[model samples]
Target: MSPENNPSSGIVSQLESWAKRNINPLFSKDTWITLGEYIGLGRPVSNRPITTARELGSFVSSRSSHVAQSALYGYLKTRAGTRFPELFENPKMLASINLAKWHIYIACISDLAAYMGVLLHLRTGSDNDKVVRLMSRVVDDIVDEIGMPDEAGDDFHESVEALKIRIENMDFSMHEDGDAVFSVSPDALYKWSPIADELKRFDRTPVKNSVRFRWKDVRETARNLFDAQAVIESFGEPGSSGSA
Candidate 1:
């Protein structure tokens, strides 16, 4: 089937579209592969085989090289049109960096919405707290995956904790619509909703685009895992812990 007719490809297409229009117009083919490699979605040059989901997960969790990390930083900088050295030097100012990584995370989360939504539904207790945890995990996972300095983990944790506090202290009643507002700027607030809505759609409509998938076969494999995960979620089995 054509990518525009494929459900899986459709969601990714929407995410890419949103990112292109709002976050970064320059998030091109090279950017996608750079991100894939940065996040360990592509195989390393070592000829290591990632035959199973288990193997893929294991492979992704492993630390990447300094060069790969630098390349991703440069990519983000170019997209942002300015260098934000604080992204590497300080974790407390991440949101201030205002780069495309958050958009990428939200988009990726949207692409995984089918599996994530079901998993969220199956949770027994307060999902709000879990959402905060998930957000923290998102930051932690990216930090870990990028092979950030080990000593800086504490700073990362502190920054995320601060963000959580800001979230807890936010006033939802200030808005006429009664929607919870974050501490970020109006522009960020505007950008977040559509991405969240896209994430809320477990089944999404197709969109046409000429960009081709070229990040090795692992790119397609990663996309296919979303559908497989949805089927696995349908069985109502107990969910297991893993990273994205």
Candidate 2:
């Protein structure tokens, strides 16, 4: 397909829109539904949390079309006890349970979108690509809101610079066995853990960092944007969902 007519052009716009909308501090439930649709996973039609990890995993597994599958499954499985311990341990609190599930669904979609962007970057290894550039902006916006300490600035810049070098260096190489390889090593991607780690810290923080990170919906969205790449990579390349 011609670059201008590529389906990804539209998908990039949709992904950009979703990223921008979710970055807002005050998103409604309807906004959540729209974000879900952007990821090719429609919003939950009902108000109940999936009662078990297996069910939650299955629900996400059915909806996913990219590399974020395993990470989503693992996040849903552990989120109840870790992120929303009160709601997870006490199923009797129907209101809280419903709210927690709603948050989880939103988180799953954000993470799915964020990781998909990362994989697209890794696949093409191009900083100039529309999708990768959009994803990079999303990452920068999320981290900026999280408010990194001044002392952490150098480390952050160094890590980011290293990641850039790695991305630029990605190209075909000959193996000893005479095989041509055109991919990134998993470890190379793992170096990006600093960004993902900072995102998770914000995700799990009890104190509100920003209006964007204060709300459960946006917080989850930020966390997902910086989620670990290796885990997301485990599910393999989940090619694009096609035009919108």
Candidate 3:
């Protein structure tokens, strides 16, 4: 079937439209600057009225990087309240747990982007080299903005390769909603092992498994966050007022 008529492609297009309309504005340059100013990261001296690119990038990273974890936390609080009561009751502990898993969350987001990139490529029948280059560029730009750890670049590439293999084996023709492709258990990118391990430390096996089963919700939230970042980056350079 042509991509236009394909259900998976349709879902991707719908997601893109929704993201542009709803999520993009949140990552605008003006929004970043306003947030920076609110948190005292802006205008420390009379000479500097506007937030610099580095400052803006840092602020955006600090806030946006937590989007997935925030969604997962809220999900656990509301839907799995009986199993993860501390998530709702102990803000300090929750903060500590999230901080500890910050890098894992970043990895998960990166992996999901790679997975989505593969899906887009499959749906569009794009030139493989061009698609790979575009995906790499996007990841590089995000890494430049967020500043990953020394080994994160390598780890991300490995995860991308793993996701590519998994996608190649999947039968997308059998799926109706493209989003359902992402809802499979034992996330293809292999980043979820760390997250599951973290949860296992505090909860019993069944609770951990239950939380793991909800990875799709966390993935969807991360995808939206990624979409917002992509939209903001498409406007202009990261910190320029034009990006607003």
Candidate 4:
């Protein structure tokens, strides 16, 4: 199908295609073969020909990359913008920064990595909290996959604990609305229920009021694994992970 017609058209496909043609052939084209190189799975641990899912899970189960994660979140923001156009439009956001190689690696498994950027900046109180929790889940899976740094693990736990506090303490009521109006607070607020209100909201269906992010950053951020072409060889191997 044409890219335009494919509902699944995404940066992931682009990366896969590029990797299939550009990466060196030393690894050959195979799922177990490639992952085995990345982690060295089960044969003898010492003489093993394969790397268990747990070994590489951290890199394989997270967002594809920081840039791509942001792009995905930006896309989500756009999806949300369709409903809350005013709030999402020109979304002023604080982008999320990845602290560990684990963060970038996990993008291989979950799309949540791509949304990290949005999580950092997109503010919608309870909804944003939900997104953060989901991303945290992705992070947790990554931790399970690779295990955490010995001393740093404690700090990591503390940080996530702090996130929990933020999520739990968030004021869902920060936003106020009425049958005929809605207003987002802190920086701004406004409500509209009629066609006129919506019309007034969008002077030109501006992408500004709606946040849009790019995935190229993700591609760049993941250049290391971007060279992995083995995913193409396996196609849909159950264990092979990819970002959207």
Give the TM-scores of the predictions, in the order they appear.
0.25, 0.23, 0.37, 0.24
Residues forming the 10-long window of minimal summed lDDT in candidate 4: 180-189
CA lDDT of each prediction against the hidden true structure: 0.33, 0.34, 0.41, 0.32
Model 4 regions more than 4 Å off = 1-20, 28-152, 175-244
lDDT of 4 by residue, 1-244 (tens): 9877743343334434544565443232333233232222222212221122222223324333332333333433344442321221222311111232233223222332333313222332335454444444445555564555452333445444443344334433342221111111100111211123455355323322321122333333433333223322222223444231
**How many clashing residue pairs appear in each of the predictions shown?**
0, 1, 0, 30
True-structure lDDT of candidate 1: 0.33
lDDT of 2 by residue, 45-89 (tens): 232333322222332333322222222223333433322222223
Candidate with maximal lDDT: 3
User: Worst lDDT window (10 residues) for model 1?
Assistant: 206-215
Tell me how far candidate 3 lies from the true structure as C-alpha RMSD in angstroms. Answer: 16.6
Off by over 4 Å in 3: 1-67, 75-95, 148-244
Candidate that beats the other on TM-score, 1 or 3, i.e. the better one: 3
After TM-score superposition, what is the CA distance of residue 110 in candidate 2 from its true location, in Å? 2.4
Judged by TM-score relative to the true structure, which candidate is superior, 1 or 4? 1
